[model samples]
Target: MKFTFFTALILLFAPLTSYSLSQISNPNYDPELAEKLGADDYGMKSYILVILKTGENTSINKEMRSNAFVGHMKNINKLVDQKKLIVAGPFGKNNNDFRGIFILDVSSIDEANLLLETDPAIKEKYLKAELYPWYGSAALSEYLESSDKIWKVNP
Candidate 1:
């Protein structure tokens, strides 16, 4: 019984110990980068506002839009893995002003732009993405403190 309990405790704490050791050894190990890349994969969320152009709008049929949404959904997992996008969805009825929004977990506005460049809709002129720096509620403000990563408000 004692042996089994000791083994279980070691197993439970082994990862924590390793993480602590890594942090100690690499004093510059960025908490933000770690959070972005670690196994837990927790990342700061920021909204990407998309505006659809009026004149050259690529409004395909409803069926095609549905199919495209499905295809976009399929590629989302890869985006998350790359820490480019976290969550994305179209706005509801009352919020039709913008075309859509993508919540991303990138490190900078430049990174966000790169990610936006990958979208077929944006590439094809169906939409254009403008990133905005988001400061979440009081409980989640730490993630938004990185000046280099945060987007600037447009005048």
Candidate 2:
């Protein structure tokens, strides 16, 4: 009887030992913000997925892909100077699902779309861009810094 009682007591106390400092007494923990923050600094970073849909089973050659990349880089550089794009690059592997990915700090989806629409690659049917809102630990900090300006640019 005593052994069974002790076993139950041990089990009850075991969970308490596993919690670290982060799990307790974090007054800065904002439930709303915490839920939004992802593993990456997604909140401060806007994720754009560029899907290249040329045609059915039509693969873009290396030279064409390289040209498309150059076009994207040129436009992305412009946006970056305008404080829109943060980072842009093609996915390391050719997964065929997406042509590339870009991280930006734009105000809204419409703004992002507008910028994307101007890309030669998109205009030439080389790619289509999809924008998704992201959140992360440092996102709130970044957002606070730029609070004077609106972040959402959708119409």
**Count of clashing pairs, candidate 1:** 0
For model 1, name the residue pairs that clash: none
lDDT of 1: 0.55
lDDT string, candidate 1, 1-155, tens digits:
56798899999999999997776344554676555443232333444433333224567677755665455555555676664555555655554456556666554677778876676556555566667765332213234335326658721
Report every candidate's CA lDDT: 0.55, 0.59
Q: Which numbered prediction scores highest in TM-score against the true structure?
A: 2
Kindly give the stretch of ten consecutive residues in candidate 2 with the minimal lDDT sum.
37-46
The lDDT of model 2 is 0.59
Give the Å error, residue 115, model 1.
0.7
